[model samples]
Target: MLIDGLQCGHFNRGVFEELRAGAVSCVTITGGFWQGCIESLDAITRWRDLARENADLVVLVRDAEDIDRARAEGKTAIIVGFQNTNLFDSRIRFVELFQDLGVRVVQLTYNNQNEYGGSCYEPEDSGLSRAGKVMVREMNEHGILIDLSHVGELTSQQVIEHSDKPVAITHANPASVIPHKRNKTDKTLALLKERRGIIGCASYRNICAPEHAESAEKWAEIVARTVDLVGIDHVGIGTDRSHGHTLADMHWMRMGRWTREIDYGAGSPENPGTTAPLDWFTEVRHIGRIPGALGNIGFSPDEVEAICFGNWRRVYGEVFPGGK
Candidate 1:
């Protein structure tokens, strides 16, 4: 099980235990997204407490060495990451502190303009702000992997060109494969490759643009298209799964001006009617269903492995070595 990116807080104790007991190999756990500096730090403190209690099942991985060691010891490696840069709060030095706490990946913004850059949902994507350039440089200097998944196209391109190190669009689809603002265009995919970046294909229903409520099979089709455009080597998995939450949570996410206006309507229906309640544990199972779906796309085990975990491991090794 290639544990793609997800929020650490989404899982309850039971779900966490189940995942640890499952065949999961590793996971990039998100700690920050739409959080301010103080709140982000507090979240990490909570993670620290969880890590202490779940030491046997969870090992906080700071670098490549830790990942290898965890695999050898039959433990799940947790790659720390931030889904957004709201924690930065216009302070570049915060990057060093988060890096010290084992954060390896960070997206510049969530769904609106920030000190760093414009979000994909932003109406006017003027590009990365002046502060954003400094933040990019700071991230590069500290060796933290930058993510462009929720960033606007112009801002994404600018960051790619500005950063000395390779960045990742941790979770996105191919625009040609599924046309959506969240999906990356063919041109952006090519540019990322040119800059030595990777694209983690997401399994989110919204990103895949399911017709009504489709099966996980829809996600596999999106991945197949991503692999076609960027090839197996440049592609990887980042499920963007928000388990332990429901359509209400989805509505909460849409409350953001950018996400609300663009993704969801002005307000979620007062009553969601009778939509099936979400099962957090099923998220992992849904991702595991992808390989079978890929078989329909003519992908072999080798290609599947690359998309599942190998590519991410390779990139993680390059970005963080010696577990630091």
Candidate 2:
């Protein structure tokens, strides 16, 4: 029962089949990035439609039991999530509406700041505003898991202290490992653990050191080091594996209506596009290889299971309403 904490791959019957092939019991895939209310609704509707169209291959996950049911039925469970809080459009009550529409996880910010707070790329780090605080409590009341994968450090720290629920850093590595702005600092990781939260080891190559991108063993070492920092129970996999989208779509992800000039994002002028794929994690089905890499790194079978599945299951069960 492997539960991937985050993915943003192209959704299709083929992708769903690949998820089954990977034996991924549940996956929290991105539904919206910088989309506002209307666009976000369209994204959610598309996902719902895809689940209906491919009922034999997948089931929509509203709770942890749905994941168990999908595994028992030999199907993959799809958990819809957003990479930004823009879907709310500053209307707090819409959180419940989106949750009803099958959204379970939401990140507070993307690469840029919005109504909620500052982002990783923003120059200022004002932390959470009063409305951001209200939004946190509202999400808590409605059982939406708060993800701070791309949020600014100051903002993320404030959220960890304020959110009643245990938040998630759904797709990031440690700054101590790679020293990237997108990665979390050791202090942030410590606060997350203290709050009983979990951090998913992001497999995006840019988040990792360049020299180690192609080595599965080195990637597993990152996971191990993260576990060493925040206990095994608070770590899991977030394969930021994206597929089926064109370079234009990728650009949209990087500069979503915010800039006129091209934003290279993690790439530079010499390589101004998506990061090269990690050799061990280019496709969704490649996740099946992760457990072996963990085992090779001296993780016990039970410990490997916790990293690949149990830890995420515990977080989902605790965060989702009626999941426990």
Candidate 3:
């Protein structure tokens, strides 16, 4: 199926083409990531226009019901999402605006602290702020999924306790396996699973060790570890592939933080100096390598299927119904 987290800027066209070719079934299309209100609005508008033009290949899905219907009709469904709450800018009302525009999942922060809470990369990891608590409640009330992939540890814990509904870690690893700041510890993973939350395994190279040279086998190994730690039902694919971008993109993600502006201060930088080159963008062929890697790990097709897309379908169904 089409498993995705965010598709912003000019990369939407190629992504849509892939989906049309049956490359995947559904995509959790992320629109907001570190974008201010104006930027988020503009991005959503562009996505709407694109959806209209590609109506044959794309169906705007707001709920789990639409995903089921789209799969039955052989059309690709797009689930809108956000990687950071910077779009809200600490204003709770914007959650409704984003919900109106079809955003379903939202991460509380990026790699740095924002008004809502500290990022996983923050030095102190102060957890969710007062505004973040409000944001979580608002998201729950509106049926928007709260994603904690890049959020600080304390904040992630607080969100699990505070939010009534199941939260999500859209893209993260098991810290016990890889020991990266971006990864969740085994205890955190267990807690989230206990709460019936979902943990999406990211395919981004950095999340893997020795960042510059990680293969699909390495990714599968990580996935297996996560599945072993957490149950198969709670796991899914996030991929986190920023296809069509370059090291320039990585630098932009760093936002000059590589210069030590905001130190995470706890452990070493997650996958330091392991940024993938622009050439990686054109090589979608690597995606299929995952199945082979899973084979090496001795996972049956049924288990692989769950990790690849089945688990995501189950979770998406619970979150959005007919693009609600």
On lDDT, the leading prediction is: 2
Candidate 2, residues 152-207, lDDT tens digits: the string is 99999999999887999999999998888889999999999999899999888778
Better of 1 and 2 by lDDT: 2
lDDT of each residue in 1-324, candidate 3, tens digit only: 445443433445666666556355676766755578898788778778888888777788777777767777777777777788877876799888788778888888887788788888877988778888888889987778889988989889888888887788987778898778898988788888888788887765556665324556656777787888988888876766655655455455556333545332222376444345223233554554555667778888888777777777766655553332
What is the C-alpha RMSD, rounded to one decimal, of candidate 2?
1.2
- Model 3 lDDT at residue 191: 83
Among all candidates shown, the one with the greatest TM-score? 2
RMSD of each: 3.5, 1.2, 3.6
Write down the lDDT of every candidate, Cα atoms only.
0.71, 0.88, 0.71
Estimate TM-scores for all models.
0.86, 0.97, 0.86
Q: Flag clash pairs in model 1.
A: none
Who is ahead in TM-score, 1 or 3?
1
